[model samples]
Target: MSAEPTAETLSRPPTTSGEAVAVHGVTRRFGDVVALDDVSLDVGPGEIVGLLGPNGAGKSTLLSLVSGQRRPDTGTVRLFGGDPRDARSRTRLGVTPQETGLPPTLRVGEVADFVGGHFPDPVPTPELLEQFGLTDLARKQTGALSGGQKRRLAIALSLVGRPRVVLLDEPTTGLDVSARQALWDAIRQYHAGGGTVLLTSHYLEEVQALARRVVVIDRGAVRADDSLDAVLRRVALRRVVLTAPADLSTWAGVVRSRPVDGAPPERQELFTPDADVLVRDLVVSDVEFRDLEIRGASLEEAFAEMVAPESTPESTPESSPSIEGAVR
Candidate 1:
């Protein structure tokens, strides 16, 4: 294939009309395992959507179908206005999987230029490097780069082609706090430029950081899809901490409760939908309660409740052996 884009490619515009990603009643199965079951979602232009799900919940499978890495067993997958399997459609799409390989001998700048060369209007190598904070390491070979640097470069490559839509699967799996923040900034810049993003994250904080809209998937099914606050509201349970006279687990609003072990006497925690009513009852009944505290649940707490009673597999930074090769 030619490194440079042809006129036909240049003439084709970004995904400016209709949904950037559309999946309707899609079912994808691997042998006996159903990866996706009747999944339907529409992501409009310039939207940042977060796909949150536990491991084995089909997050990766859904991304694979959308990115054309795998064909769905049933239903349709569309990218831009065309089929995802078509190169013509993929021209407007960019992707970074959970894991990526870098050429060991290629310098950072060289790799960027080589990838950028494939697009009709690629970001300039210098400008891209500077934007991603890879300018200082421009001359450094990939083999010598640190884990965080490789991750930053991997994401930077996704935008090299100025794609209108990008699919990221667990984008920030492993990185220091500062490096993760830098990547988040880059993502924000791209979205602010009207680029649409659909990303899956194991970290609730990551989804909270980048997604205005959140979609929770479980057992190959969509549990919730709405604005961040709206989805969080799904977890109506509240936490009440206090020093009570006796067990509060049997209280009217309490869904679950436990004693703060190894602490002061009668110290307990109560979870309920209405914290105010729960506390009001305590005061009305004149329960010998002291140090009462009530607060709304955080995003993390909500996530835990949403996918309760299941073990969530975390996607930590991959610890892989060094890859030795040279390619753009």
Candidate 2:
């Protein structure tokens, strides 16, 4: 029951400067605490950008500003080059916040229709429900759906208006693997039809799968914003796993080493900047090792390094000049 792109999907408004979303030097505070500090970001039309950060790192607050739920204290947020706070500007924008309050007594289909009725042009309720895998729950009351179903319906409603840009805050927080993949497909379909998306997720793999560009925020500041490959490459660490007779934790070229849990005592995993150099050292030293394996760092490893307490701004790769000072 997948829905094909409608005429409205192909007729998005031309963006100013080719930017779907623009946030410049935005700052927001909550009494004594600064939620966002001089953050600036831009999402081009038709791009899927991932916003990543720890809890209370201002990720939600930033989305609130972009979605016009909250105003910035000292900067500007624009949707298609217009003030986001303006209703006319928001007509083309869609948002799924971390929490949504659906009508308890309304059926799923009824809620979809109610939301779609607000826009001049909207995706048909049936098609939208099918695309999100909610057709079976169409007749069920909103409060009766499971947590994951509610999340899917919330995301589907965001697209009822066929918006040019959508902001998703933890869209797959409660979804299972299958449900998450289904939602990913729906997002891809929307993007293929020239829609722009900005999403935040704790799942690193979600960002790795959907976004070409990644923006990492921590401590109320932009830590790094660059292509996913560039961000991963910035962390030069590689993981090497092998079974060795002798302890390799103190070996030269090994940045960190630990025993592989549930494995034999000889099985060790090592982190090193250069796997080749470490292997060379192992061979030269006549180390007795077997089952050797070497692989590049994962997004999780890269993220850990990026937000590590010891990481300083000066240590950041020159390619990611957008990174602000170290997380304090």
Candidate 3:
């Protein structure tokens, strides 16, 4: 590839007409054990999709298939309407793995420049370093950076090619609150610039905040794929906390409320999806309480219920090891 392609040769014009990614009846297995089972989904341009599941729930496998690192045994995966494994097709995608795989001795700027050399039109090394908060450490060796700095550098490296679709697997793994926030802002900017993002994260708050849609997979299959609002409504289990003025038995419509062990009996509440009607009737009937709180079910809670071990195999690999190699 040329060191740099001009605006006309390098930039892939924004397309309002492509399925950024598409997987149909995808399945993969290891001998007798299935890793992914007939999973199918579509990601459109400029959309951020969250993939949520428990350990060994095929989250990483699915991402690998989409990124062309692994092929599905039973189905087809298309990136920009071409085979995922094709080199030309892959240039359109960027990836950030959970662990940093950067060379320890390379300076931050040098590392970015080295990776950028692979692209026809790389984002300027200095701009990317600054964009990811690594400007101050531009000449610092990767080995000398802190955990969060290393992570930020890894993220900057992933974007060197200015890819159209970005796959982020636990993109904010080791960053502190401020650093994590910075990454989130960068991601928002990426999406705003018309790039597609597919994120696999165990952090429910991360998914809820960043993803416009979510695809929940369990037992190697897609259990649910829908918008955040729709998914939350379907995964209807709310957390209810309240203070009781009298005995639990006296409270009407109280599904269940027992004092926590070693806790005051007067302070009791329970979790239920029907919080609106349930609490409304109680208050109307003169139920007295010092405090009350009703919170919606989070993606974590929904994920726990969806991918509970009962539906998966007894033993399986917990996590995929991060791929490591020099960026050639």
Best model number under TM-score: 2
Compared with the true structure, what per-residue lDDT tens digits does model 3 show for residues 1-328?
1112133222445355468898999999978979999999998766789987666678899999998999789999999888889888888888874455778888888888888887889999988887887889999998898888877777777788999889988788657899888788788777766778899876666777788798887668898899877765655566567777666543444433335334576776454557787678777877787678788755444454455455643332221212101100
Kindly report which residue stretches of model 1 are placed more than 4 angstroms away from their true locations once superposed.
1-17, 97-100, 235-304, 307-328
RMSD values, in order shown: 10.5, 6.8, 9.5
Better of 1 and 3 by lDDT: 1
* TM-score, cand. 1 vs. native: 0.75
Residue 79, model 2: lDDT of: 88
lDDT of 2 by residue, 193-286 (tens): 8888899975677877788788988767888999877754564479899999899988887765556656897898787878999999989889
lDDT of 3: 0.74
lDDT of 1 by residue, 111-155 (tens): 899888878899999999998989999999987988888888889
How do the predictions measure up, each by TM-score? 0.75, 0.76, 0.75
Best of the candidates, lDDT: 2
Q: Give stretches of model 3 more than 4 Å off.
A: 1-17, 240-271, 274-300, 307-328
